[model samples]
Target: MQEEKRRGQNRDIDLDTLDGQIIRALQQDGRASIRDLAASFGATRELVSHRLRLLTEHEGLRVVAALDPGFAGHHVLTHSMVLVDGPVGPVAERLAELPDAVFVSMVSGAFPLVFESRHGSVEELHESLDWVRGLPGVQRVRVTTYSEILKGFFVSPERRQISLDSIDYALIAILQRDGRTSYRALAEAVHLSASSARARVHRLIDAGVIRISAIKSGGISRNRLAIGIGITARGGTEPIGRYLAVSPAIDFAARSHGNYDFVATLVGASSSTLLTVIDELRTIPEVGAIESWAHFDIVKEDYARTLGRVLGP
Candidate 1:
């Protein structure tokens, strides 16, 4: 009863126009100051601060630093669809608890439970899949390994060789928890001057080692429809993948080596809105065949992972 009441209260927390503006601003720069946001919007700092607090407290808004998989030493990324023999809720709950799971959801399709996981190496990924196969309700699992991620909120297109020290790793750990952590706090934690800490963070961000952004808990709207798309291209996957990546409706798109040449995730306000996007995709000459699944519920969507796992010994 208490859990039900809590969920009811959460759903009742309405977001006004100011809330939307604040969210967008934070999405662009999660570390933006409250004073700066107020000045940009021409609103009172108190009002903006109050709204920001409410959004985080009720809307499940998280501002965190997300690392590039390749830059962070994560060599393998894969999306898995699981067919369950019995109740899917229990199986999905277990899957969400897995450390490597960056995203997990229940969808309305042949495969009910789907998840995306990251790994340090191919060997580690296989061992993780073996463990998943042993789970009680899992009947079958199909995996699509990502060769290149063309678009994703946490990923950067550019890759560069940059050396990171223990201090850098420590700063990354802190920011992963709270991207808005003050430079003073970071300096205190790392035993460095605030200016030095700020410089290091800027250097890391400039190098495309990490992205600081806001991550929402679920679909942006109550009526939002989320779809997973698998595309087979006529010639090469690059052109199709790049096209899908640029669409405003598509949040994630990647080139993969599996049953499908490319895979993407789309979010829209309604079925009609999503269908229109799909129609446009079909019109692309390079696109051959497409398979899509409607997501029913997003059980988990956290991207933060232990840096040590990827850092190696």
Candidate 2:
């Protein structure tokens, strides 16, 4: 395909079936060593490692840790849609700087900007929203409480009793920047032996404190589509939320309190496939209303990138 740039994104990178498989495996287990990935692919470790680097450095793929803030002392997660009457650029950038803001996107629709924030309590969330409402482009803000995070970017369900010390925090900081960093490199960076470094990573993963996964590139492509869906349920929201959680097209889903009962992100091969996924949601008897916004571009995704910033210098 000819390389085309849309909204500062290039869509011409060639990705073969092998590249796709590697990405899928990493998405499932970001801690998968090169040897392990090679075994799964029936290829050599050197070949696998080379392709991994190419994908990460050239194809916009990132291997990073996805932290569960709840495990790290955060208690509240809220999904917010900010409708602005002025230039969205400034407002979106301001939102991204909020201490609680984790994911921020400049999208197309009634709400030009959408973001998710985490806090230690309802009061904190309210304070943050109040501050946001007072921003210069101020118009209106809708805040929806996330009753539960059925499925987040790369957060897993399993939880473990674990304590994080300064060393552990440092390790997470390094891994958040490069999930596929070699054990020896990680050990050296954190002042530990290779074996010990590997053990700590496993403990973090098993405890569900952090998840390593591949973050796919974002760009408008003739072969790909991304959509944000707002769903309202009639009888109950859990069933529909769970349904979305298991859907192949769903990249993210959460049950919320507000104008919509549930929110989801879907990625498909084409517009027809996206519509098919919506039709499937409509078939559910509990579905009352659904609204979808096509994502024009994604400006920022924390994906554990801000953990170090949140933790301190």
Candidate 3:
């Protein structure tokens, strides 16, 4: 990650530990043998098996190889940052009600609300933006177009283990938009026959390139509070980012080039604990500036939102 940051690029998660082994292996090839992961971790398969179960039940982690939209013809991937002064729940709720909205956050950054809003086409995107631009509490929205995605996974970087092909890239882009793309249709799109396409998709699955699955969004815990924190690091982002990544309360954290330099998205069980976490973050020597935002409700959560135009059946 440090090397990637030096190059102004991103490093995929590392997958070397027992837990990382389980997450990455299962994410790409869901049916991987515990014995194999255990061997990689220098532990017994039973122990690895137990750890895997805990990761699922306790962490609520899903090793999903979600679809890519580019191949299925819904190619646009748009991100928007929003700012709001007052209660974000009301506005978040209203926005979340829309099936098209995805990945909503109330953070203390350049954009209070960052979304992976989608569109089937450029014309359609502009049309939808017309409505999103008018949403209440949305002080302003700046949209950025993502032409390509180098990497994405639900689990940490340590879990992303796979190789890709030209076809895999094209297939992922399509599946990002249309998760239900059939093997036959995929073959036709990528200039392969049905059999080859099916084999390639399965290989990509084993290699950890893409996944075909359903998108469900009801995992919110009433005990969990979404707290957005921005930390400015003096030594560099890696140390602080690693610190936040291992934190029990932190849910989604990233090193960004923006107002705070680094952002940590955490899930606090209670308000007091959340504040305590903030205090701890502030105490870190490298931290220069820290800002936080608390949310009462989450508007939207969809993995496919990255491809843009999140839609429902």
Candidate 4:
């Protein structure tokens, strides 16, 4: 292994123990201030801020606020599996450009590209998929609609009854791009006083309308094994879903109403560790059968939303 250089010289700034800890802390609270991070890391506030800036500017790491698609006028969320007759790269890129696409990736398995999309209604989703199926290199498309979201990475499960105006939408759009943006900047972007902008952000967070968390950069090495596991629950999926949610190896888990009762993403340092986690899942009495697929490469992963259409003028 090569010795990693400091100063974020290249896209390969090695994540040391401190860096990992900082990331975990940010995942828990992306809006944490420099003083808070410094206290947690036992470092000076200035040092902590410098490190964070280096990661964001050079290593592609970002902190972003995630919004509930439903709250943003998207009532339907769908998971799609796409098979391409020709090159997968071009097909995957085209899928990513779809307005409703929330997440898209090229994987190793029965499907070459898998993506999650959000829509305002069933008709909209269908039309989007119809256009995708008609794409030149497209061979087939498999769709699985999410009934209820058990967990959505960084988003809260609870729904807010709050109504939003243009100001709120503008603020959300800014945060979606950079969750670490300063209060002064947020106010300037949305044309509000800094104090008022700060207040509104807290209200949104407390209302469970949105959440902020650190996003791991795509430049990060894929040396570690990454897999997607589909699970069939014997009874109600609550128990199994809860169990998987707390597992350290599992990054994403959710209850679904499709071929599987639940779906999860797991990452481990090695194949053995990955297998070990799967073996543990097998031990769960509520788990019936499990299917696993290794992730080949993540072609495009974007969580940002186009608020103008959904939020409306």
Candidate 5:
């Protein structure tokens, strides 16, 4: 019993620089070994080990082997944008408790709330929507079927306080298609030289402007239903959105405003896993007051590559 108490106490500390580095390294490659991280970061193995322990125990940060959901059986992918008109708290919390709801976010402008979920078929997706649409405070819902995916949102470089430029967007566009493209190859695509391309890539990466790496896929074709959900937030959207974005189950979460109060996207290994993720989201304390809808099909999944329309940084 004493040992259990001690173990619980160990999980409450904040992450330091070295720990953050560990996260960064894992972000680059989840399969990295402690030996590799220690050597590269100039930290002792013991130090690295202890830091890892603290991160998991105290910070509640986890190191999980995220797999390609498609490998597990989920074949359909979709995006849903939800808007809530009541207290965003209970609703967001309820959404977070979902198992398949891996991504949930709140936004500021047009559609305030959004979500993306994966499922096995359109019929099952419609069934899920029937439940979401009936939730209290839901204003309206829309759906988009994604025929193709231009990009997938992923980990970006750490943020930098520098101003952004159109060149940044150009660089992003090139990398979005092929993150591992060599500098020479990128230059060729964007009409520049190899050295220049190299410099730009490094600078952008360091500046938290972009991240270049490969994301695993299920090795199968993907089709999806994108859902747009609207709800009235009784409290506000920011708190609920922020909480959902940081959820451990979420692949990526963000805030946007339009027809919805917030927008988020989640991934799952299968339809059941997706449903489970959404169930978990529905349990978040902040989401007690909420509403949602399931998108029937995905029209387009541009992912973060849509920076093109955002006008560069």
Candidate 6:
């Protein structure tokens, strides 16, 4: 029943069309100009511009800057599954309100609420989890601490540590709010020349310190099924982790130390596509077992963390 509803909602946005192509292109490079996008699609600039406007205005598309976890001083990444005593709505709402909660959703399976959170240290991560376990209607919480995040919509696996000054921090803060902030505005905020601001922004992007891309306002995707998978590996986890990380079907993959050796989030146009991916996973010799869950509703998906809060006043 839930799957059918999601399929109906997904049909609203067809990815094979020009709009979908534009979105995919922008996801790679959000700062692409309208002219560049139109040229790539062999479409008129006016049409492309109109479609872009429609996507941002009505289609829940948001172009923003996704900061590297290390750059943001976040070292701990965790995926938690919550089993509620009674109603799951209230518990889910409370979890979604947490500042550290990057992704929150209600899912099918033993756990009704699944959320992902980040912390600056292991102590902070455990403290946050303890608080969640004490929340009203919360029964038990199972957490998987990620040793390394391979892929995510807002997080880049490439960690290029760079020395950032006050001005760089300011620029990052501004871009976190809006990735497409004009060079002039960025210059004014950081008190730098427009050209210098542009140079710094480009440098940061090139250094992999930050990623500017399009992120959907809702869950990972409104037009696809979002499924979470937990895998137990036979040998070492590195090989299996690398394979899942590189797969196009799996957007978010991580190596973790818990019940599952690796956890991955798969997005597909239909259940059959997701099933095919699962079957392929089963065929892998290293994969010993797999646990899968479908997300019924995504309550929150926010990765934009305030630099001031992270860096302190």
Among these predictions, the greatest lDDT belongs to 1
Off by over 4 Å in 2: 1-20, 34-51, 217-224, 305-313
Task: List model 6 lDDT by residue over 1-313, tens digit each.
Answer: 9666545544454444677678777777888999898788766666677788888898777788867777778899889999999989899999988888988999989998899999999999888998899899999999998988787766664666577788888888888888888999999998999999999999888777788888665444545578999999998666687789778888789889887889998876678889999999998889999999888888887777777787643
Give one digit per residue, the lDDT tens place, for model 5 in 1-313.
9666545544453335576566556546543567797787776566677876665565543332222233223445555556678754455455555444544444333445554555557786787667667777666555543333322234342346555566655776766664545667778877878888777777766665555432322111122122222323445555556555565434444343333344444443245655665666566544543344443322222233234332324
Per-residue alpha-carbon lDDT of model 4 for 1-313, expressed as tens digits? 2323222332433446456667667877888898887677666565577778877777667789887676776778777788888788888888878878877777778787788888888999989999999988898887767776665556576766887778888888889888889999999988889999999998888787778888764413433456787888897676787788788878677677667777777865568878999998898889999987777666555666665666664
Residue 41 of model 1, lDDT score: 72
- Per-candidate clash tally: 0, 0, 23, 0, 102, 0
Instruction: List the pairs of residues colliding in candidate 4.
Output: none
lDDT to native, each model: 0.83, 0.79, 0.58, 0.76, 0.50, 0.82
Which stretches of model 4 miss by more than 4 angstroms?
1-15, 43-47, 219-225, 268-273
The whole-model C-alpha lDDT of candidate 4 against the native structure comes to: 0.76
The TM-scores of all predictions, comma-separated, are 0.86, 0.85, 0.49, 0.85, 0.42, 0.87
lDDT for each residue of candidate 1 in 1-313, tens digit (9 for 90 to 100): 9666545544544446567677667767888899998788766666678888988898888899988888867789999999999999999999998888889998878899999999888998998899899999899999999998888878876867888899999999999999999999999999999999999998888888888888777654553468999888897656676678778878788889887888898876678888988899898888999999988778888776777775642
Model 6: how far residue 210 lies from native, Å? 1.8
Q: In candidate 3, which residue ranges exceed 4 Å CA deviation? A: 1-21, 24-31, 154-209, 212-300, 304-313
Q: Which candidate, 4 or 5, has the higher TM-score?
A: 4
- Reference-based lDDT, residue 125, model 5: 74
Best-matching candidate per TM-score:
6
Candidate 6 TM-score, true structure as reference: 0.87
TM-score attained by model 1: 0.86
- Superposed on all Cα atoms, model 4 deviates from the true structure by an RMSD in Å of 5.0
Clashing pairs in 6: none
* Candidate 6 Cα RMSD (Å): 6.9
Error of 1 at 74 (Å): 1.5
Ranking by lDDT: 1, 6, 2, 4, 3, 5
